[model samples]
Target: MNWIYLIMILLATVAGGMIPMLVRNLRPNLPIYMLAFTGAFLFGVTILHLLPEVYHELGHEAGIYVVLGFFVQVALQGLSHGMEHGHTHLPAAEGHHHHVAVFPLLFGLSLHAFMEGIPLGFNYSDASALPSLMLGVMAHKVPEALTLITVMMHAHQPKAKLWRILIIFACVTPVSAILAAQLGQHFELVTKSLAYMVALVVGAFLHISTTIFYESGTKHHELSRKKVVAITFGLLLAFLTLIFE
Candidate 1:
């Protein structure tokens, strides 16, 4: 648990996140493609990395609450139902666009991101599990960061304001890592808490993956055989990654 490795992990997260922004200049279709790839990557991480780790740490009885993770996410989405759809008035503001109310969505994402740092903190090279957790967080952060960006942009917040929000979102991973590191002696409690957080993350990823695939403006009616193969291959790859990992 050398402190330097934690710094390295944090740096890697920053690098992983920035890759998308570098390709930010690409065509609209390219981002969509990247989004699809990122989605597949997240599905891989959630199913492969998070779920397995948690299941191993906490058996069936405690794990039943895992499905509660899905319900929790659905509840979040349901509460903010208007934002996902189209424009609707915020309850507090009464006439503003619904995205104004999207801070809760951002809050959920941030909380999840903060929870992710825990594993990265405790996960030293000695533990076989750390890498997958790190990779999943890294893979998922791209879209999460971009979503944070677009959500802020859609809200018409200033560039500075958006950056501030992104900065706060970015800091959570490292903060969680530090927190885990500080409490290293209490591994059991850490494992239990992380297990629940991972379950929550799996739910969040499941929702995002399905939403991106089905709800994207792309038309399935005209989806060609090749596209179908690509998406199927993409999903299959994700499942296999989970199984093997």
Candidate 2:
């Protein structure tokens, strides 16, 4: 296993989590646009690279795991209130202390993070797909980390406690990557296991990317010109990366 993937992912996770702290005064709409771009890029990568790779590696049986992963993500998003897609709805006033249950939210997000790590760790040698997959995962992590921090702040968690929680959340992916590497070593048919895991993560990506695009519009669900441009740019980037990869 190449240790560099672990380091890169860990750094991306930590940087993403810390973004909210650094950009507390950023315009809210900016992050939404960023999320839209990331979502589009991820969606493009899934359709272009991941889906084909999984089907090629594992045959048609991999579709079942993809469907299962999609529903699993649906269930997780329910618990997380759609945080994965930048839906961090909070009360207007920070002074109003609502009893926000943290455990369920953390559990859902952590599970999602762990699942994401498996494919990257297990398939690190695939030069054609790994770059795009890594980029998609890293891009998605930023908005997710930002949303998670926003929610925790809204819940009035202490700064120290919030940092601790964020660190743990950030670590989950790398830890899971290491675990997946270990599991791969144990499996006699490691390629099949990796293919199935990639399919599962691809399903989760499909759910998330679609949700982000669907929600990224006006009340009437009309996309703005700027948003269209951003989405186009994202897709183009993904295509170019795939071509060059």
Candidate 3:
């Protein structure tokens, strides 16, 4: 079942990267809508599901780790140029160019994916929690992968190179999950450590989700009606998933 989940994740990642390449004239507003929906869903999952579980397992120390994770993501953005949060640093107009270093960008995105996988692979809380976590990760990954491919395309990376990077990026999380699961079986202290890691990820989620909200708006920080509707739908879906879970 875990293998199945991993394969699903990998396929979703690759498919996301393929989308922008397949469709030349993707609607300008599409990514913004995606960002709003996934942001709200991820935020809801972290607050309603992950935080309570981590705090229950690790107590106040978990809060400190959450803060650390938040800052860790802040630092990671320097390397990733905010790719994980749907940022494509494309130039504004025909005469301008923005240079992106591919290696650092891939490294940062891989690290973020790896961290997210740890709690899921280790079964941080229980079997039931996996569904919610998996759903959130999948929702987030599509826009993220789209951003990655878009950035690489703008940078004039070769098609083969782009595919290679996308494959590597897609594998990172599944590999991390498998590795974490193996480690948990061997180490007695894995449970507590897993709780702390989950706390860290919860913090990362909070940062990414809120950042989406912040960036999804106009100059006045007001959301457009369509985006607001998308966000509401996402929240409602999250709530329903929790109820059923």
lDDT of 1 by residue, 1-245 (tens): 44554555555545544544455564545434444555565566566566666676566643565577666656655544322211122444335643465567666566556655756664432254465556555655654565556555556677667657666767788787877766755777764465566566566656665555543335552444443454565566565554433
TM-score, cand. 1: 0.68
Shift in Å, residue 22, candidate 3: 0.6
- Output the lDDT of residue 237, model 3: 78
TM-score of each: 0.68, 0.90, 0.93
What overall lDDT, based on C-alpha atoms, would model 2 receive against the true structure? Answer: 0.79
Flag clash pairs in model 3: none
Backbone Cα, N, C clashes tallied per candidate: 0, 0, 0
Please say which candidate is ahead in lDDT: 1 or 3: 3
TM-score-superior candidate, 1 or 3: 3
Q: Write the per-residue lDDT of candidate 3 for residues 1-245, one digit (tens) a residue.
A: 38888888888899899988899999888988998999899888888788888888888888999999999999988888778887544336455555777788888888999988887765645445677778888888899899899888887888999899899999998898887788877886875487788888889999989888867534555788988998898898788776545
Report how far off residue 179 is in candidate 3 (Å). 1.0
Kindly report the root-mean-square deviation of model 3 from the true structure over all alpha carbons. 2.0
Badly placed stretches (over 4 Å) of model 3 are 88-97, 124-127, 217-221
